[model samples]
Target chain A: MNEPILRIRNIESFYGPIMAIRGVSLDVHPGQIVSILGANGAGKTTLMKTVSGVMDPEKGRITFDGQQIQGSEPHKVVQKGIVHVPEGREVFPLLTVDENLSLGAYTLSDKGQIDHDRDLVFSYFPVLKERRGQEAGTLSGGQQQMLAIGRGLMANPRIMLLDEPSLGLSPLLVQEIFGILKRLNDEQKMTMMLVEQNANAALELAHHGYVMEIGRIVMDGAADVLLQSEDIQNFYLGVQEEGARENRRWKRKKTWR
Target chain B: MDNAQLLISGLANGCVYGLIALGFVLIYKATEAVNFAQGDFMMLGAFVTIGLTNTEYMGLPFWLALPISLMIMGALGYLIDRLIIRRLFGESQTAVVILTIALGFVIRFAAGLIWGHEPQTLQNPLAGKEIRFGGLVLGMEDVAVIVVTILLTWGLYVFFSKTKLGLAMQGASQNQLAAYYMGIPVKRVQGFIWALAGVVAGIAGILFAAKGSVDPTTGLLGIKAFAAAVIGGFGSLPGALAGGLIVGVIEPFASRYVAAGYSQIAPYALLLAVLIFRPHGLFSQVRVKKV
Candidate 1:
C-alpha cells in the first residue's frame, strides 16, 4: 500500500492533569476523506488539536508527509500545508470576509497566487463572495461555517483537519457543505480528516471511518462496511431489530459500559 | 475674541496631550495593559535628546540628535516589552497594571539620578519665532506642536490602514492566538508595536520640551494624557486626538472664565461626566463579545 499522507501512532494528549486522548492511532492517505465519529467528551477534538499543533502530545509520534511534526508550533504546522478548521468556526469576527481570507494566506509570499486562491474560495461559496466586504461576525451560523472552511482553503492546504463542520447547521446546509467537501476530495484530490458527531452525514461522505469512545478508537473500517454493520446500525444509526425495542435500554447500557 | 485665542492655544497644548494619549491607546490595544511608565518614556526621550545635543556629550546638531534619540528610545521600548512586560503577561490584569506603575517610579528616579532634579531647556529651531495673523499672535512652538501632532497622527492612520505590518499588528491586537494560527509571528509584531510607541513618545517629548523646560517629573503630564484617552475612548486613535483637544481647550478656558482651580479640575470633571454618560467615548465602537 502507498504511504499515508498523515499518520498518528499511539498518541496521548492531556488537558492539564486530565488525559483527553489515550494512545489513539489513525492514518489518512492521499486523496481520501477519513472521518472520526464520537459523542461528547470522546476526545475527538483533543485528537484534532494534537495533530494541528495546538496541543502537545505527551507520547507517540505524529508525522506529516514523512516529517515529525508532533511538537511544532501552530504556525509551523500551517507552513507544512496542514490547515486546521477548529471547532465553533473561529472566524476573526471583526475582520471583513476579504480580510479573514487574506490573513489565511499570510504565510504565502506570492500575492498573485493568494488572490487566485481567494477567487477559488469565493467560487465554492458564492455567499461569501457577495458579503466579502462585510464583517464576519454579521454572517449567519451556516455562512460562518462556510467562511471558516473558505478561509482554510485560502491557505492552499494539502490536507485539512475539520472539526465539526456540521455543528449548528441545518440538514440542508450540512448536505450542501458535504457536497462541496466531496467535490474537493474528488476533483482536487484534497485529503481531509473530519471529526464530527453527525455520524450518518460524515460516514456517508468519508472513504474510511473510525469510531471513538472515551479517548480510544473502538472500531474502524471501510465506510460501507461500517454502515452495513448491525452494531453500527443499532447503536449509532438508530435502527433497532424487530421485537428488540423493549430490551434496548438494558442492552445499550450493557454494551456501552 | 478672547475665547478664539484660548481655543488656539488650548488646541496646541491638547495636541501634545493627544500625542501622549496615542501611546497609551496603542500599547493598551496591543497588550491590554495601560503602561503608566509611558510618560516616563516621553521624559527619557527629551533627556536623551538634551544629553545628545550637549557639547560635553555627543554635541550633535538638532537634526542629527533627533533621529538618534528616537532610535535609542525605540530600542528601550522593545527591550522593556521583551524583558519585563512579556514576563508579566497572562498574569492578572491588576498585577500588570501595578507593575507598570512601579515601572513609572523606576524610570522617574533613574532620570533624576542621571540628569539631576533641575529642569533643563531644549533647543528648538523654531524657538522664539512667531507669525502674526491680523491682531492675533501665535507662538512658533504652538504652531510646531499642532503641525507635528497632525502629521504624526495622520502617519499612524496611514500605517494602520495601508501597510502589511500595520495590518498584522491590528490582527494580533484583535486576536493573538488567531493571528498565530494564521502564521503571523505575533511575538515579533508585539515587540515592534512597543518600539513604535516609544518612538512616538520621543517625538512628543521633544515638542513638549521645546515649549518650556523638561525635568524627570515631566513624565507626570502622562496623567492628564491618560484622562484624554478616557475622554476620547480608551482604544480609539482619532478619539485620543479629539479627547486631547477637548481637555486642552477646556483647561485654558476654565482658568480664564471660571477660576484657576477649575482649570485644574476641568479634564477630570469631563472624564467623570463621560464615564457617567457615554462611557465608550465619542468615536469608539461598542464591541460585544459572543459566546
Candidate 2:
C-alpha cells in the first residue's frame, strides 16, 4: 500500500498536428519496477518522452512527486530528479567516457557527492572505468547502453526512465542488461519505468505491467497473473500449443483472486 | 622595398587576417550562425582605441587604451548576444543567417554615421622603426602582429584543450541539447564565446590599424575573414587562422605578379576552389548526422 511516486491522468501527446498518444494513464509506485509493454508505433516512446519533458502533451495531467510537471522544459524536468535515458543511446559521441559521466552530474554542485556518484557508476559498469579515456562512440552496443544507464544514475534521480535498453543488442547482451537492471531494482530498491518492445522479458522482470496497443492500455495487472493468462500467451508470449494453453489457463485461475 | 620586405609585410597582414578568421570560427562553432557583424565589431574596437588615444579625449596611452578597447568590445559582444542572438534561438538556420547579415549592415551604417567617412591614422609608438634581418626588413608593427597572433593562438589552444569551461563550450557546440542535459548552462557559454571572439577581433583590428589606417570602410576586413573561415572549414579555429594567412600571403603576390586588380578577389577565388575540392575546409572535422 505504498503511495505512488508518479501519476499520469489521461495524457495525450502529439507530433505537430498528428496525434501520437491518446488518453493514457498509469501509476508508478515507490521502489517498484513498472514496465510499459508495447509494439512499435504503440506510443510507448512518446509516453516516456512526455514524462521526461522532451515532448509536451496536448492534454492531461502528469504529476511527479506531487508536483504538476506537464509541458515543462526538459532541463527543468531533469532538475526535478526524473532522469531519462533516451532511445538510440544518444551519448555524446565526441566526448570522452569520463567527460560524458561528468555531464550527467551537471546540475549537482557538491564536489564530494559528484565524485562519490562517479565511483558508484564506475563500480556498476567496471568496463566504463577501463575505457574512461576513450570516446563514448567507440564503445560496443552493450557498453553504450550501460553508459547510458550509468549516465542516468549520475543525475541522482529518484526514478530512471529507460527506453529500450535492449534495442540493437544481441540476446546474450540483452540478458546481461536485464540482469543488471534487476540488481539495481532488487538491491538498491531503485524505482524504474521501463518502455520495452520485449513484452515477455519486460513482464518477467516487472512487478506490475501495462500493455499498450495503439496509444491505449489494453491490459494491466500483476506481472505473475498476466504471465499466466491465456490472452497474454496468445498475443504476447507466442504460445500456440493447445496443451500449453490449457496449463496456462489453470495457472491463471490459481493465481487470480 | 625589396621582394623579401614585401613578402614580410604580406605575412604580417596574413597574420591579422588569420586572427580575425579565428574570431569568426569561434563564434560559428558555438552558435552555428556566422556573425556578419564580426568585421564591424573589429572596426568598433579600433574606433574605441582611436577615441581613447585622441589628444582631445581621455588621451590614454596606447598600451592602456588597447586593453580597455578589447574589454569594451568583449562587453559589447556579450550585450549583442543577450539582446539579439539569444532572441534568435531556435530560429531556422536561414533566418538566423539573414538576421546576422542585417545586423552587419546596421552596425556598419551606424559606425559610418558616428565616425564619418574619413580614414584616421592611429599613432604607432614604434612607427617607421624597421629591423633588418638577412635581406628582409621587418617593421616593428609587423613583428608585433606576428608575436601577438602566436600568443593568442597558443592561449586559445590551451583553453580549449585543458579547461572545464572550454570543454563545456565544445560540448555545447557539438550538441546543445545533450550539453544542457549534462548540466552545462548552454546560453551562458554561448555568450562567453561571443565575447571571446569579440576580444580576439578587437586585437586584430588594433594591429591592423597600427600598420595602416582605420576608416569606417575597414569593416571590409570581414569579407577576407569570411573567406578565411571558409578556407579553414568554417568551424575550425586553427583552420580560420591558416585560411587567413593563406589569403593574406596569396593576395599580395597575386597583386604584384598576377594582377593588381584581382588581388582583392584572390581570397574569394580560393574559397570557391576549396568549396569545390574540400567542402569541409582544410582543417574541419567531418560531421555525420544520424537518422
RMSD of each: 2.5, 4.7
Question: How close to the true structure is residue A108 of candidate 2, measured as C-alpha lDDT?
Answer: 77
Counting only residues 3 or more apart in sequence or on different chains, how many pairs clash (N, Cα, C under 3 Å) in candidate 2?
0
TM-score of model 2 (CA atoms): 0.87
Candidate 1 docks with a DockQ of: 0.53
lDDT of 2 by residue, B64-98 (tens): 89889999989988988999889988888788778
| TM-scores of all candidate predictions against the true structure | 0.93, 0.87
Segments in model 1 whose C-alpha atoms lie over 4 Å from true places = A245-251, A254-257, B55-57, B289-291
Candidate 2 lDDT by residue in tens digits, A107-143: 7778898899999888878999999999887788788
Write down the worst ten-residue block by lDDT for model 2 chain A.
A248-257
Cα lDDT listed for each candidate: 0.88, 0.84
Residues A1-257, model 1: lDDT tens digits: 68999999999999999999899999999999999988889899999989888789999999999999997888889999999887888787777888888888878879899989988888889999999999887888888889889988888999999999998888999999999999989988999999988889999999999999889998999999989987678777888766655654543663443
TM-score of chain A of 2: 0.93
Interface RMSD values for the candidates, listed in order?
1.9, 2.8
